[model samples]
Target: MTDTAQYQHFNVFLAHEDHKSEPYHKYLKASANYETYELKSSLEVDGILYVKVPKTSQPTWAKFAKSLTNSSIDELQNNSSSAVLIIRAPKATMAVTFGYGRHLLDMECFVTDFGIKTALNTLNHDTLRSVDVITLDEQGVQKKSQASRSSNVGVFGIDISKDLLRGVTGSSKAGVGLFNISGSGTTFSFGKKIKVKDMPALVERIYSYYQSNDYKDSFAWVDNIRRLEEKKDIEPLNKKLIDEISKTNPNIVISIPEMLDWDTITGFSFTRTKRNIKPTIDSSDYYSSLDKDNLSIDSLKRDRLFVFDSSDEDPEYKLYDCLYFEIKGSEKTYILFSGTWYEIADSFVETINKLLAEIDITSLEFPEVYTWQETSGKGKVVEKIETEGDYNERAALEKNYYVLDKKLVKSSRTTTSIELCDLLTKDQQFIHVKHRKGGSAGLSHLFAQGNVAAEIMLGDRKFRVAARSVIRNKVSKDIVETVPLEKLDSTKVEIVFLILGENSSTLKGNLPFFSKVNLTKAYENLRQKGFKVTIGGVDKVVKPMP
Candidate 1:
């Protein structure tokens, strides 16, 4: 095809759901550069085809891509030098399929969650921007950006990004194999290749750690795998697991119920069995009611180690009615529960196993546990009341700074949920101020509240309008001149969890592990929704008032 004709005859095919196809068409139509084609039973001509698939329909999309290779469709032919396939999905399977299909069809593919924006930007050289974009080279290897040309290093055929590889190796050029790249120019290889299916999760896990400023542990994890070949030490294993668990939010504690060898196990009593199968009983309602009855015990059990709702508070319903256990070992005291296996302390496996062996037979019995009472007055309702300390911190920030406000008032006709977040700016900065005399556990509540407010700001449009209205009413004259509502979308919202305290030493040392992980996860979650997120202490903000 002639150069001029190639440009003239460029065709775009859109494969998307009926609801999502309009935007793709609209953007393509606005480009005014290429001819668009619709998917048909039979085809006649070939050009650059753009495929937009939702994350839920990735499997079907993959199958469709595979079908194109074997089909006898004459229109599927590419007149240009290369055909383009864009797969927009969050699932790793779609990415793998895109990579595989690129090789099979001799087409260049771009994989992203940003969808048609990235595709249109690349094809038309439009000024539109996207967060992250991945493209496959001629060899079917994934590239983070178009600038990444080298393909020497890859895990399980999926090319590793330079940032990820550099974070692991701390260098541009590094050998690929089963090995640990260390600081002192040391390499230890495990001699086993990671499976292709497992590479996505592994890469994401490592890259998240690398991104979270936990590079030391990321490197140690790779090194520990090699160490497994030489020796079976529990220390490295414990460290490796603990590091993995730390990245997750809300903390996970895993435990196995202790039972004596001689004790006879019995099924639930008739009353208990009736409660379980009752048509009127919602499991959550029953559990929550139980929590109210056990409020005293729950308060007594609440320590600096971990927080548990007497009932299952986790959105996923993974956490249930399980008592917490503090497993103290040489390294760290890990809190254990029955629901999640993520945050179990290091040395727990060895120590717990030993403890289980020494359990007395006489102590074995069906333990007395609190059940939900319908008429219980003492409910476990820990209302988050804003304190004087919170007001003081807000005053300090507002008095010291010009660009922010203390209270982000969300106005309604009847009522407004007083957002714990104190400082908000017209530039879309959302700051939550927390002043606690206790340990990092208090900071968790702050983080949780901050995250919730951030979510509301990002998702709830009613709140957004109300917030803008409140800003105009409250701060337009006194706090600031006026509040602009233009830059207040998800992309513009920036969440800051600011913890104020006198004990800087303790906060600094424990904050990174205790608060940083949850905050980082929150940051990531918000970032995925196009909002910016950050976590820090009083030092990053203003000085703590004496």
Candidate 2:
């Protein structure tokens, strides 16, 4: 806890599965390009460093502090730099890492999450510092929390403790790409500061604790989590995602990622729109080297974004901000969230599917009369989609559904414009049709739009006045006779979201996981407002196979 115990603040690492047999130095390399380090732990080298000697980086600001003009600053300040140190226990397979040496080891060579398990083994009132967690969802969140104070700090966050915990690394945070990973019982990280007169003793204690299995299940309530990066664990998962990105498909979506968990931070106000998410359009702009075989996390550090408004202070984001990818294999479904890929648990996926089934999205058969033509891009894949205006007009003429697509009416309530619906029917079904291409983000926008239009139509009289005028004059006066505006019953107004796509199947299985969250929220709100809500799907027109 003091300067006397310089090695006190260190991270404990367990050798990756079967990596225990390898020489201690084999697991990590010295970061200095032109230098080499003796892999053994020499007590002379800061009592823990594996390098031949203690290599303290010279702080660039040290010169200014020692200058003749103003040379009175007592303590020398050092900016962050990395140094490698690893101490392996003579008894078992454990490595004690000090300084920034944790970065030098390959993720495949050792396990980092055991540190959390060690924290739980501490006495109930012992000094526990912080906890990190990753959510086992497609959102791929990583969060570091110090919710507990020194005295009240137990094994977990008591009031904040919930279930569904897992272990993962490689997050896409806003500035440093921190994925909002989820918590307690089992955390992504757990640590407490303690003095160690000898480094080997600390290694033995951890190795014994892991080997004993006594306290292992003493916190069995917290073992609901598992780590995948212990040994070559993430390679296969990364392989699947890389394949999708190298090609083009919904399996991988590379766009501007929204910032997460900034709302809870106490410093300043932050909004999603405050910093525009720059889409990672072309990968070549960030880097010329595209590794098809291996992934280098450092490459992403160079890929940054600076286009936040000059006048406004905001979270600095990277160009390769965040990525979302999902793949259904022969057995389990895998989701790549943030920068880490996790295997979706079978029970978890089933639980979600069961919940989704109860949501009751009405699937009315849509009229399939449209055709697609080669307007741009690839062969049959890049066919120009029929616009909403064209689709509604044709549907009205050919099928008798009233076209209300572009009848934009300025609302007095919101002081903004509102489009009632794309098509209206005699039975009071107000349908909103949209082309499904932007993945979940596009669908979320549509759901929100549909929900708002329904709210405006039902709640606001002025919105209805503008809606009535636009429908009567712009859309059709005769159509209003069937569904009168003066006595528009909220119950009879059916809000339908007709999503058109060539490959999407019935808006259920193919719907991105995150979109389902938005869809459920919109659906519940509309239903609570006493309006009938239904999800409708139509096949998009695609170029005929030659």
Candidate 3:
């Protein structure tokens, strides 16, 4: 017998109903290099375990494979340091077992009818030698297959399926350039410009990425769970009712649909209008007059204001009749509600109270409110401010210094004044600044903000006029008081996204490359919108002061 020490070592486990088919035993016995043993009851093995299934139907083999993936197999893997399972079955049976084993067990296992057939074929050819023996090592075996004259390319050793290769390459023609089968091994090239010497490193990187489980496993049991979830019946929202109500004017007082009528229900309608309002008149009175005029609400316009009304009719208990919500500049105020002017206020009064029943008052906490000294005298009283903090200040500063070069003047101090774009330049540049501090910041928010800002600026005439007035006021100090009217038009507005702290280590964390990839995709989308867009990170904008 050949010296067993020279060849790869494996512990064999034969799982058969009866001793009818024992070709695997004969084959293993003939190979003097392998130390074969029968697995009695315990799965604990010192070496590799070859589970030989009887020559049966595919379904039966699959059931057997699944049954073996219980606690016993797990215990075997936990106890044995170099435990491996080689499932030898029929072609169809092997495929089923291979998939199941990979999904359920972490142990290094493989299924093959070809490996057994090749081992049996070795008896005839005296010169035949085992090129690569499957081992218990985490890294799987690699084999090299010849490339055929046909477009189909075979890569041995690497378990990349043909479908996976096709999906990655996109086309069969491109597949040839990416993968080339050679005598030594299957060489993989990343791109057309990649050097031949760097192919091995690239292949190793790909292998490492896959092995690390950075991407979702195709053979994972989670896939089946996800597929089952996808098959579940999920009811969609009623779009017909939403579409009908969305287009209807809140002032028109259209009757509610019988199907939608419910107790204590509220409905909201949003509409954008180019209707001009004088700053001197009360906003509530102006909005109320629009309702009386029976003006048709156009949902397609920009700078949309939402109107909400509840079904409650009892006047004594009603909190509001109809809430006309308007967000002007940065301030959020309910300008009109049930023919009453809504002003944000605070009233503090000392109260003497007795508990009717035992209450959990310890859990309650008082809300914080901003207050300042009204007068400098001894009898000075504290006055509360409705709002606090300038959230748009940082974005405004970023836009002014980076994009416009501090050319434009400061617009209105309100939040909605320059919420979208801080500066409207002489060259028709609309600059949107986004500052992020943490790694979990999503690029989608930045994209949406910039896109919506551009959309409103271009589509809404009243908003454009207000924007022009702000820009005109700024430019009047530097240039002539009468700036060209054509400059205010949205015809040649170029959007610039000034991103601050984008490359900060705190903002990008471990997956730094993914941020760049996401940004590139966002850039492409903005460009597709017919806007001349430019993205500049903090590094590109900030330079050493000379």
Candidate 4:
């Protein structure tokens, strides 16, 4: 055979069929066309293993039975690992339970790799390729397959090693802990001493985390288990859920903080409002590599935020409730939940007012503030107009200042406030933010300032304006607050741009060149200039001559 055909990798399926064609059996068979095999002397295959586990093994299976009674689940089986070897395919992979029966004295082995190999006389070779490996709990069922953990769910076989828990939260010998934490604020706290029924789900979560080496953020998962003992709501743990959590930006990640703000009204003051929104902001002056990469709507999902825009079928229609939050100690932020923009903005202002009025801020000098920016419409992913001289362009400027031409200045009228609103219109949409405790040092303070670069094609001709950032006591400032209202003279400006809307096919006109910029890049450019900015218009549209 040719080299390509002579040496090739094959996905392997290993399953125990003691319960007939139940879920596990069907799962494997349907996933990869896995055929059954037997360990008898007459039946053999080069690289496949299908075990039929006899009825006698079922009881033992729930206890600590590892592999099939024979070397195979079916009539054909292979014992060696070769080019074509057994492996858990992505789809067939799951969190499984492994432990000795509750009644088995001195037979306390878990279904770890060591235990599995010993039972089947096999080896699990390490392969660099990423693949899914589903394992079962000793209960002969899946942990995530259950509906809820509040109703006396049993875990069968699984125990957390005291040493492991100690290393994570510095809690030593804290008793075999089990918890159930749900989104609905229900909680069950079991301090060690776990039972078989409470062991499966816990063990599965731990094992999955261990196998994936994704143990860093086990707090949330462990918290879910902790709530189980207290008869509280339980957040379901599964591969899919874990994957979503893992995808968010970790450097600046933080748990949702409890609201502590209580204050009065008008503009951006914590004195008139309470802090109800929780979001994580950049810890440093600039963006980290991880934060930069995940600014996309796709990554926002991991942050518990869903962002989407309307389609051709519904332009003015919104999909869900939108929530907005601003990072307290960082540069102001404009976040939109994927929902109706106007409604979210109104609720945001009201919630902040109520929250502030409820807290004690006598000693706390609230650093940053959040308020609703009047936006034009409700849409997914809204922000202020983009402009040049944002955070990304900070490194590009030779000095602290940049120049804007007079033509780009247009009229003297411009929105001087850095805060603006953008709306998201998708279900389950929210933003996670972590801000500095309470000080100006906490704000990212990134900003953008610019005048119209050139006049738009009112019908045809282009007109230029002057606007850009200039050194204000050595720090870059883009706004010309004192400019003449009739004919502003802007020497420094931050150029704002947008991208073409996805539904512009029917519009019989050309879009402005400034409309094609990406949001993150645009914001970064303005921030570099030391001009705080907010963005809007996820897709692009005609710019109003503000």
Candidate 5:
């Protein structure tokens, strides 16, 4: 993408949900005259913004206020701004408009619950603000604003232009300067993007800071000056005003506006701290916008962070629920979330195949594995070992013997053998078994047929002979038949097979040559028959310790 294609817009708002309910509150009070809250998005405009309002209300303006307050129920919402209006374009790009309450909202409003709420809506092309006109200089600072009242419009305007609104500015070359709204007194700064009536001194001060060597500390000092302005108890200082007047440079006094049209080229510039980090494999980053439908997965893949709000069309991808990333070269990316770091070190093939469809990635490589263990519950590993129908098919063909000839291996490996396991050699019977680590394997069963519809086993088995050919008694009708293997006094041992498709009671003694077993019921019966039995399933029966 070109530099102009990368320019982003944002809008700031100033109002929370309570602003609608408690408009009289001091926090909701308008200490300043202009809006300071900012909203951000990358969506184009479409006509017909869907507006919602409360069912009961008093006045239309109050309703307007209420609608504006509650308008956040649309597609995108945040506690920072009152609402976000996104304009969808035909080319899949977007023109976003941010709305702010006209008053005391300030710069540096951290996203907090009690801050504000932004609503999402639609707008006609005429109503949309392209925000493309706003530009921060090489030092990441926006041009100065003309508003007085010590309202740092420069900061807010830069934020609003860079973070919110977008559009082309009207030119001022001719003697008759063109303005969007009707008025000669309305100050103009960088064309249509900003107005600068009161910020000439502030701009000069900022420019002086730029010329100085300790720019960082100077900028910090300017921020302190704003803090002093925000303090209502103290009288406004004339000393600072006098210091600003001493500057003799006309270039600094005359706030010359830059002309930028909607088609002007612009790009975003990010400055990073000089901190070195060793790359690790398997860590990935994700970046997404709070706007939906306009979600550019490609941008998210590049930025490595996802943004969202309540008004978003579908917030599924928001909240960092599940994000996948691909790394490039040998350098690794670390993902820090929920107070823990996860390495994105999967093999290149594995990572690419899974995340490739979701993002536009390049030069990404495979990541190495990083061990992570869950702190609370039993973290179990339930992996399906891919098979080419090898041992599974071998077990079904055998009969009369435990075809599954295996020993139990715990995570902390100490093997235990089961008796009669070698009986598989006698009748060619087979079974497959593996231990359930981390947590109880819960109720599980193996089936022989193509589909599993077998009764397999039940925890209780014994009340048989009642569900026989007749239903003699109501209470006895529901009972099933079962008996302990040890209690069976028969002269010969019946070969009880747990067929996959056959229910325990469905056999009805047919083909009595081989006994049908209800392993679940049999185990329960054995427990009732004075034997300590806890084998829920034969997969990996854990015997009770002696």
Candidate 6:
């Protein structure tokens, strides 16, 4: 080291391998105001920028203080600076940067995730001050957070844990980025910030930072989770989705992602502007939105589909916005739902899909039924009032089906009554049905309810007695006497999740990712109890709103 060398903090940015030899102008953003510096060193270019902009607005506290009888407020102006020091090396161009210098450069001029890779390679994880973590699942369930508290290091925010290691800040022999944040942000840096007296030292730091980036992962703990994709990884996964779906027989399909009001959404169209369009219950019809010729992601974004009002006009629930598509990557599975991207553990998605496939889904058969808002009821006029459960219960009774939709079986143990199933068929099928959407979060409760009911049906004999008695007491159908009681055979009982849809294919695609995980657990638990479990995507009979 030079005797005149001084310590300084600087972030490092590595140019994309392809653009290593590009001119400095190509590296900077267009019309960037920067002054050149003459170092007379082996550096290609040394540029610095000082920005002086007026504050957008005064602080609220400043205004309130000035409102006092006597107060003085000299608003401070904003003064910030950034520097870009670049050196052309063999096969690559490395830049020693500080502050928001990159704001003055082409956003994509540098390599992607180079900072994080370098930090993981260079820094010591054990003594690191903080780490950022994020989690995303195929269900569109997502969470991103940062923690200053290590089990050993103090954590800053409460309830913060690592899901994806985005940034790390702490002391390192190779130095750290500004404020110690690395990898997950715009810049990868080395050395602490300070006045630089020696030009040679800063130039050397650039090469060392590059070396730190090229070095293989040596931090055992940090490298352990590198196999997982960062939550912020979007474009690459999106391209992967496009590629995977382009393949023949891709196990992916367009789904409704959330529980939408099917009653209002008579059908869907890809083109937002269409007249007298036929309403289809399925979401896959996004292609058939009257402009079926061009079905691509670009089209989905450009010609966002809209759900129409009952008269096929004056509605703007963007269909494109609600659509969800799932794809499995090499290591993780990703989903694009409600216009956001999320990734799930490939193992979780695959396991759930496999388990879901095991439970045969029979086509649900029912009249065109829906949640109706009766406009001419007893008192004030309501729009649509009959709930899905009410429809199911009434339909089951009319057909002489053993109706148990709301008949609660009191649990002698917990003083709680559990609904055995929505409707029980004479053929020994105990059906549990839900009119639900949104995502896994919404369906989780339904799955939990079904699982608990299934367990109680098989193990709790007292509950079974109460279940049959409730039907016999509340139901007018004589078939209530035939309801299984006194002696129960688990093998003979069939537990079905009746979904009001055209077929199982819809459920397979539309069901949320985490809901499928819960379904898998429920299926296994029920299967172990010697019962046949299935998902029924039944046909719903539609009647014009009464």
Predicted model with the maximum lDDT = 6
Residue range 145-232, candidate 5, lDDT tens digits: 3332222213333431112122222222233222231111111122132222212232332223223333122122121111111122
In model 1, the Cα lDDT at residue 187 comes to 14
Quote model 1's TM-score. 0.29
Q: Write the per-residue lDDT of candidate 2 for residues 183-213, one digit (tens) a residue.
A: 2322222232444435556566656544444
User: Model 6: which ten-residue window has the lowest total lDDT?
Assistant: 153-162
Q: Is candidate 3 or candidate 5 better by lDDT?
A: 3
lDDT string, candidate 1, 1-546, tens digits: 211212111112222233222233332323223333343323222212443221222333455666757765444332322223222223211121121122222111211112222121122121111112221111112233221322222222322111111111111112222222211101111122443233334333322322232323212222111111111233343344334333423132221122111111111111122222211112232232333333332232331112222343311112222322333447554433222112233443343334323322221111111122132235522212223233444444554422233454453422547562666554555666554322233444566667776666555657666666666555444433223344445765567665543233344334422333344445556767886665444322222335
**TM-score per candidate:** 0.29, 0.54, 0.25, 0.21, 0.16, 0.58
Candidate 3 per-residue C-alpha lDDT over 1-546 given as tens digits, one digit per residue, 9 for 90 to 100: 121212221212222223213343332323223233453323332122333322223443455666866544322221112222333332111111221222222111221112222122111212122222221111112332322322222222322210111111112122223221111011111223343233234333333322343123222211111100110111111122123234434321111111121112222222322132111112233234344233322211121322222454411211122222221223212122221222221110000001101111111111222123244245534222211122223333443422222333223332443344543454555555443321212333454456666665555555555545654554433423122333334334566654443332223222222233334444445555555665544421322234
Candidate number that wins on lDDT, 5 or 6 = 6
* lDDT, each prediction: 0.33, 0.53, 0.29, 0.22, 0.22, 0.57
CA error at residue 124 for candidate 4, angstroms: 22
Candidates sorted by TM-score, best first: 6, 2, 1, 3, 4, 5
Tens digits of lDDT, candidate 4, 450-504: 2111112011121111222222222233333322223422223222322112122
Model 6, CA-based lDDT: 0.57
Taking the tens digit of each residue's C-alpha lDDT, what string does model 6 give over 318-416? 444554566666886666655666556665566567787888874435543453333322453332323456667676767656667777879775557
**In candidate 4, which residue ranges exceed 4 Å CA deviation?**
1-6, 10-26, 29-35, 38-525, 530-546
User: Candidate 5 regions off by >4 Å?
Assistant: 1-385, 388-458, 462-546
Which parts of model 1 are misplaced by more than 4 Å? 1-333, 336-399, 402-420, 425-427, 438-441, 478-493, 502-508, 512-517, 539-546
